[model samples]
Target: MNKVYHLSSCNTCQKILKELNLPASFETQDIKEEEITKEQLEEMEALAGSYEALFSRRARLYRERELNKKELSEADYKELILDHYTFLKRPVILNNDEIFIGNSKKTVAAAKAAVHG
Candidate 1:
């Protein structure tokens, strides 16, 4: 299903969701409210190619935990994201089975074209 995984409390997420101009048929999951399921994450991983691609290295917890100091494998990235919602890159958009990760200008632009056009 086409969806957007986002944190409702994050302004960047809110702004992207708006900017994407998603249709009513496209579901939006607030990761903060309903945590991502293993199957769901795995599906994203399948589309995204790796768990690390979905992980947000910029999260406060990532720095607080000093994960950068350690070498993290794909499994580690998957486990970390499943453990905490913050690990997910904000506004992970899945459209027509094509995944758009993070809030970068290129990603948002791509998602906009995919969803609306």
Candidate 2:
């Protein structure tokens, strides 16, 4: 199954989900309703190169909560995400060993190619 971790209100998340159109094999975890496991978040962060990639710096949560990236430790990040899932980025798609952060044609194509290859 493909698990998507994202905020429901994010337009990018909606757009990617709409574009993918994979309802049967896909499951979406609303950031507000479902907390991503620390291990899962850590894996994605490593794959994307940083916790910043896993978290949504551009989201209203960041601005409204006044979350400064530089002030957070790795543990703090994990706790924050666990406690408040809305801080995560939109459309964080997890398919097998692959993870897609945000939606872009290049990212989609690359993920597909890698999976199919």
Candidate 3:
């Protein structure tokens, strides 16, 4: 499966998608428009190892809700991500069995290579 889960309004995601230049075979899912389901998140977690790996602590809601002050568990991470779309990191790309999560330089580079190569 060649799928990219991203937020349409995020600049980083837009830039990455533009850089990737994916073909028609690639599928794009706008998380804001279509919220991620539990099954989808579970699939991602299965490839990513854990929900924590897929969760983004940099979201504005995280700080606004003071989630940083509290200790979060695996379940909390999953719940937060499911409840709010922003809790997820931008641009989660799934290329076959390889899953890339986040917008870091290295992650984006690797994702691009996977799709382009």
Candidate 4:
């Protein structure tokens, strides 16, 4: 399955999608419009190895709510992500069994290469 989970309003996400130049068959899921289900999160975790890997500490809520002060467990991460879509890192690309999470230069480059090559 070739899918990209991203926020529609994010400029970075849009830029990455353009850069990816994915085929017409590629599926795009706007996380803001459709919240990610627990089952989907589990599937991502399975490929990503851990929920923490998919979690985004950069979320404004994380800092505003002082979530950084507390120690969050695996379950906490899952719950937070489920409760708020912003808790997830943007532009998560799932290409077959390989998963790429985040907008870092290396991750984006790797994802582009995987889809193009």
Candidate 5:
């Protein structure tokens, strides 16, 4: 599965995607317009190891809800991501069986390598 789960409105996600220069075979999903399906989320979880790995603590809702202070479990993370798009870390790139999550310089760099490799 060569796919990307990203927020089109986010500059970081856009920049990283452009930098990756993915091929036509790659699929891009604008998470804002089309919410990620449970099957898609489950597939990502399978590659990523856990829902918490795919969750974004940086989301505004995370702070607004004071989730930072809470001891959230895997189920909580999964539910939160399903509840709100922002709860998901941006630019989740799936290069075949390998999954990459987030937009950090390191993560983006790795994703670029995977896509271009």
Candidate 6:
């Protein structure tokens, strides 16, 4: 199944759902409710090439909490992400062999290709 990791009320998540047009094959998991695991975060971090890329830098919590990527340790990152799932970016789609960070035309197309190709 195509698992879309996202926040429940995020407009970007909704937009991805709309663009996907395949509810049957996809499953949505709200990041807040889903509770991102350390293992999963590690996997995403490895693929993303940096922990910062996994975070939603634009969020108020990010600024309020002062989550500067340069200052965080691996363990610190895990705790922060665990404490606030919203700290991570929206619509982190995980499928068989691909990880998509956000909703965009390029990302959607790549996801489609990764799923169908």
Q: In model 5, which regions exceed 4 Å deviation?
A: none
lDDT of 2 by residue, 27-114 (tens): 7788667667877787788677777666666656777767764587767666666667666766777777678877678876665564
Alpha-carbon local distance difference test for all models: 0.94, 0.69, 0.93, 0.94, 0.93, 0.74
lDDT of candidate 5 over 30-72, digit per residue (tens): 9999999999999999999999999998899999999999999
Clashes per prediction? 0, 0, 0, 0, 0, 0
Residue 101 in model 1: lDDT: 97
lDDT of predicted model 3: 0.93
Candidate 6: C-alpha lDDT: 0.74
Residue 103, candidate 2: alpha-carbon lDDT: 66
TM-score of each: 0.98, 0.70, 0.97, 0.98, 0.97, 0.78
Off by over 4 Å in 4: none
Candidate 2 stretches greater than 4 Å from native: 46-49, 108-117
Q: Which ranking of candidates, highest lDDT first?
A: 4, 1, 3, 5, 6, 2
Q: What's every prediction's RMSD, in angstroms?
A: 0.6, 3.0, 0.7, 0.6, 0.8, 2.5
Residue 14: error of model 5 in Å? 0.7
Q: How many backbone clashes does candidate 1 have?
A: 0
